[model samples]
Target chain A: MAICAKIDTYEQMYLIRAFEERIAELFSRGELFGTTHPCIGQEATAVGVVTTLEPTDVVTSTHRGHGHFLAWTGDVQGLMAEIMGRATGVCAGRGGSQHLYAENFYTNGITGGMGAVGTGMALAEKQRASGNIVCSFIGDGALAQGILHEAMNMASLWDAPILYALENNLYAMSTHVRDTLAGGIVPRAGALAIESATVESDDVFDVIAAAEQAVEYVRENSRPYLLELRTYRFCGHSINDERAYRTREEEDEWQRRDPLARLAGALAETERRAIEGRCRARIERAIAAARNAPVQDLGDIGKGLWKS
Target chain B: MEKLTVGRAIAAGLRKKLADDPTVYLLGEDICDPYGGAFRITRGLSSEFPGRLINAPISEAGVVGVATGMALRGLRPVVEMMFGDFIALAADQLINHAAKFSWMYNGAVSVPLVVRAPMGGRRGYGPTHSQSLERMLLSTPGLRIVAPTPRHDAAALIGAAIDDSNPVVFIEGKLLYAAEQATVSEHYDIAHTHPPYPAAVLNNAAGEQPNVTVVTYGPMLPVVEEAMTAAFNEDEVACEILAPSEIGPLDTALIGESVARTGRLIVAEEGPRSWGWAAEVVARVVERWGDRLVARPVRVAGRDLPLPTARPLEDHVLPGVETVRGAVEKVMLQ
Candidate 1:
């Protein structure tokens, strides 16, 4: 069963925020390998959209995908160990944070590359009558990629059951969506004649409501639907990003709409504290388990080497 | 069992897979009825398999990416690129996603995607339409490549490529579609689980010690054979031809054994001279036979220049039998 309840939605958002906070701390302490694009303030968009999906439903993620990935798979320990390059990671340490894949879940670092693949997955699903919808998440910056439009063209033309979720955090690594995007994300899909909907809130429940309608629209219409989520990231694009592009006032303004703070305001203080405590404890256990996980041996690193 | 053109053989292979397996489908630009394919390799198959063949939008990246997605979703999809040069647009999917899925996903999945692109420089289709861009993808580890020649059954090799678990980029020589011939009575089959390099050596004559070994494949196979025939009769130089159907994961060991016997090696290909498959073959030959080599191996390749649309210049660029023969004679003299 998929996560359809309001309290469960809140719990998922809390866990995502806690996971991102811990990941940030690990990055600062030089504990994690490689670079990570933290989805700090964009938890609601990830969790809300993923909540509407069943276990059999497929989702392709982006580089800043920990929130979306963890929300879908709920494998926090595996993800933590993966980013740490441990052998027991989700992808056996092969995929760091950007690249990861499970049975029905795929998260890659490529911006617009997975768009058509997700569309193709939906095509297969529809052809096989599997009734499993596919959702591929891309950043607002990926709007510039030509492959997305090409994929959306075919997905719409063929009426494939897939949802293209655009997590508009307003910044494609310091470049604001308004400054970089020509018209807007929705209009581009609209021009392609693909049915699309937009949600302009960071509230977890609000996103869930919008996602449910969009997911249903795709399933019934048997066509690709674009869901544009209006959210903001509290932190920089990557760990090293100082975010000099946006001013302190703007950052503070967006932080006011933080999903975590909003969820807390929506719930009673004691209830909020209890959920937050459980989320924090869950993240702590995940981190401890990940730190203790065995790492891939350096000597046997080329386990899948085919050609000499 | 019927004799068929290289193009028809490829179409036959696609037809067999589409008819035999419900999971097999096609994605390409202008691949539907009336258009078939730019090279007409997929000619006359869409009507037989209605709705299975898709005339894709002019999106190389989209076509390849979608096929890769289908492959990952447990369906085999054959993607056709109208021209091999256009594959440059699909490099992201071919090099990164399709090729890296199996290994980067830590052996959890294998992409059974076959991308068939018509490659070569004989046609005067200018710089964009003509050029063997397979050189760019030869370094990608997890991808398999098959270039069918006149000697091998094109349908069987293509079928083998389709059955492969990993991604396979099938390179059909654009010029060889009409110029070369393949016997249909011959059936080529290989296991999808483990497909090694399909390397074959054709002797110029039986019971003769070859003075030189000519390593080439695909479109150059028939051309190299013609050159060896000339070199054998006129120059009195016996030559051996080693053609490997699989481009990446090439069986250099086969080439090494042949070269160790012949002592001289020459690699001929339609791609440009620099950083092409021929150069890689030469490097491997030298690596396998360091000081035992009698002469520095020669590589017969297209001149290091962008292919032009002019017929004379195009012919001047792509390696011909005369050029290969000249190289073979030069290597023998050394």
Candidate 2:
């Protein structure tokens, strides 16, 4: 059985895909404020990893984190407002898309920085016996950072209840993982005593199965678990990238294996059409509400400089 | 009232806070018992708290990042960076995350985290081990930097740092740890309840007609106090000192008031003269008391060079009592 119904997972994935598509269109028209790293082809991984989490459990995300944020909060209006830098944003416009924080979700613009933070949160939960597990999502490129290794070592040492989920999308902004990363990311963490596993496909059911097992293992063993979710990004690194590195054939191959279409194929036609309709309607409402929402005043930018 | 070295005082403060609050815990390199921290500030803490005192790996960024996460989860974690200099490794976390989490999150959460590190030079620890990095910390916004003067209680300051509903960097002076008996002198006046520990008055023998106001903090407090007293009694310089026990969000008002009255000012510190905390003190004073100054304020601080390993060389490079005394006289005469 799936952690979430197959139909529900499809809806979440559809929301992610539709949200990014709208953001890209908005960016193209100079409507969206900042650049975004869309997870167009990796929807399954984002929703799959997050569905295993309880409401009280925490997660930390990376720069390309819209999908993760939506999977965690499902607050489309607040999230879109944040991406648009509106006052009704989750962070009151201080944090845009890259730095969205909600009830238990936090995403920063820095690579691999959330690793230590998530590990620490897991440590806190274990100390309190809260039974809540933390998941920190990172990309293949973040493997170059040394801080991640340090957090991994301490996580294993402390037996923190955390899932270090890696979305190895083949490229770290065009510099292929093979070119930048030395040795295997899973083995490097394993040397620090972290239990490691890897899922082979980007299929929603496969991701749910692998991620559910990983989340459960960490919860029961009370240790750090590393999961390498094999996936690919259909788009370039960002809106600015020209993609002169990879061939067109490579892009086409990845797009053909799109996680969104794969999940839709698994769902019944009526159910799939309904979920797509709901996602489109919700996205349209969220975008309209976010645009109508007022932007933060220039004077109030520094209002909360310190917590009195 | 308690007789304790600065190190012991810090340990006592941690002990008390942990006992009082179930949420408070400690993490740092060699912080557990048997090792008791590099300077013994965490001595016997692990034995008392057991699993609460966690000895961390040599990963400053990881430790601080983890502490920030813990704070996010509502745990009051006091992290000990073995050396204040090593805090540079964790600067990104302190400056970007811990310092701004609540504010960036728009007051959605409060990070009640404490980072305790020993600062200042003079223990022959050389460049990497010894540095008065408080100057760098002072430049970081949204973070409270607190240091202790001999007049203020170290443990009390630590307790205050822990109690603060924000991220605080509690800088402990290595030299202060060597004091066999801790006694807060009465002449160094002024005492505030919280971090940015209250500024003090020194060498006000003339009471109402003090000739100069010298501002300093941390380990430089004693040296500046001695110099001010010697200048007042022998040289008739009549100096009044305003030294905040805490550093950041400096209490420039106290120094400004004293400077306005004296018409002369001197800022003495252990860090380098260029871009030191003295620069900030001078800037704040000049903004308000520029018209009142009878002479240009002098900054007495370490030379802009790496601290040498030899004791004599280090003393020569760092600002000394004679240096402060001379600056006081020079400012008074002008």
Candidate 3:
């Protein structure tokens, strides 16, 4: 069954927005450790693309990966605990926000390194004839990282079953995509001989339709495809970022097309309110459980360092 | 037993693992047949195991990152860097990604990946091609480093490294690839410490007292052995040699035990002087047995400089038989 068929993506997007908003509040209060890059405005991209994937298909995510993690695993408790540095965290409190791992979901803080890793995983699935594909999520900023290009070339040359889902949020920290990126986005993958497609919208359905096709191309052909999703980040680059790089008007413009509002606009007023109420309650409960969870023992620091 | 060169031995080890385990794979540049490997380590194995051995592009970081991905998917991958110096290009993958995954994921995943690189400067490969850069990788946490000597079965050690659950950087002495294998002789008693990834301990003459314990690894083993023999013949000084196959997660216990008995220590390596493996061995032993030594510990390593292309200049930068002999003689006097 399709993941979208089972759950309301509108609620999921609302949940991600509320969860990230709570995280920002927590960060302001010094409740969370390390730093976080929240995908507040781009929840639709995570929900739309991941819902199109199967449970068996693996995903390699980026530094700003909480949305992807939430959308894929739906383990809010584990993700919350992980962010709070608790022993019950998905990674046992070690990976924090950027580095996370589950059975089929993997993430690292490195911007573009996972591209190669995902390609390799797709190649492995192809070799095993497992009929599973991989979705490697990278931002437009990741184009500066040489490994992504190398990975794309390798994937095309090897005919690996993988989809490079590039979330173009228009900014890499203080710099816009125009300043860092050259030769545009889609053609970059096209130049590597990879099939490409693009979806430009805040609507989750548009992204889902495009993602389904891109994923099908990879699965059916047993080769790589590039899916470029144009989106925006409603939050700053990180918790501490001041947003000095852009104006309030620009933020207001993107906010008008905010995924949550767009999705809610399509729903009845009561339905939107009920979904928001449920998502808020669920997030609050996860936060409480995560906050009460014990910290990992420092004496066993080397516990997972090796497999023994 | 038919004697095999270090290259052939490594190939045999890889072949054994590939045949034994279905998940084991080989990935590198020009590793497939028609070209084999740059060092020919994967020579004829490609034909034997057809689709298992893959030839990758010149992208070092991509290859290693790909190998890490494969390892995460429950596959054992062994990647080869054409030259050890080129490992610098893949440092991000090996150090950041491969080394951090098992711990970062909190044991949810393990990368049983092996990266083999031919190290050491000889035969005028110039500054880039010929370098012992394994020292640069020693500081990486959760990363295992092994430089097997000819005295031990290189094949078995390589096999052990491949079987290891942790990511291992297998440093092959480029000079030792074609050299004839060395055998245990009657004049020495050979025993191993730490099974699986063992270190070879050669105690010359049974039950005899030694004045100094000389610790070395990789190609330096032969030079230290020769120096020990010379010191014994000339001055009747009995010296023990301990060659650890595993460098990081170093078995300092064995070295400390030998230091306790001998009360003298000399560490020799092929890499440059300061912050080299030699210093690490000495510091570890000294930290454990402070002020117990009769004289100051000596480090016999390459000169603190880049290896030049010229033969005389290169020879001067790198340590040889004379360098090892000088260290032994210097400590013997004190």
lDDT, candidates in the order shown: 0.84, 0.85, 0.89
- Per-residue C-alpha lDDT of model 3 across residues A10-42, encoded as one tens digit per residue: 888888888899999998999998899999999
Residue by residue across A1-308, what tens digits does model 2's lDDT show?
45248788889989998999888899999998768888888898999999888999999999899999999989889988888889998998888878888988888888888898899899999988999999999999888888898889999998999999999998999899999988997898779888899998988778888998999999999999999999988877897778898999998998888888876777778878988999999999988998899988878887766776
Per-residue lDDT of model 3, residues B1-334, tens digit only: 6667887888889999999999999999999998899988888888999889989999999999998998988889999999999999999999989999999998888889999989998779889998999888899988999988877788899999899999999999988898766657655678887878888898874687888999999988877888788888888878889999998878788888888988999999988998888888888888988667988999999988988999999999999989988998899889
Give the docking tier of candidate 3: high
State which candidate has the highest DockQ. 3
**Comparison by DockQ, 1 against 3, better one:** 3
Highest TM-score model number: 3
Segments in model 2 whose C-alpha atoms lie over 4 Å from true places: A1-4, A268-270, B1-3, B180-196
Clash pairs (backbone) in predicted model 2: B189-B201, B196-B246, B197-B246
What fraction of the reference interface contacts is present in each model, in order?
0.67, 0.74, 0.75
What TM-score do all the candidates reach, one by one? 0.95, 0.96, 0.98
Rank order by lDDT, top first?
3, 2, 1
DockQ of each: 0.60, 0.76, 0.81
Candidate 3 local lDDT, residue A83: 93
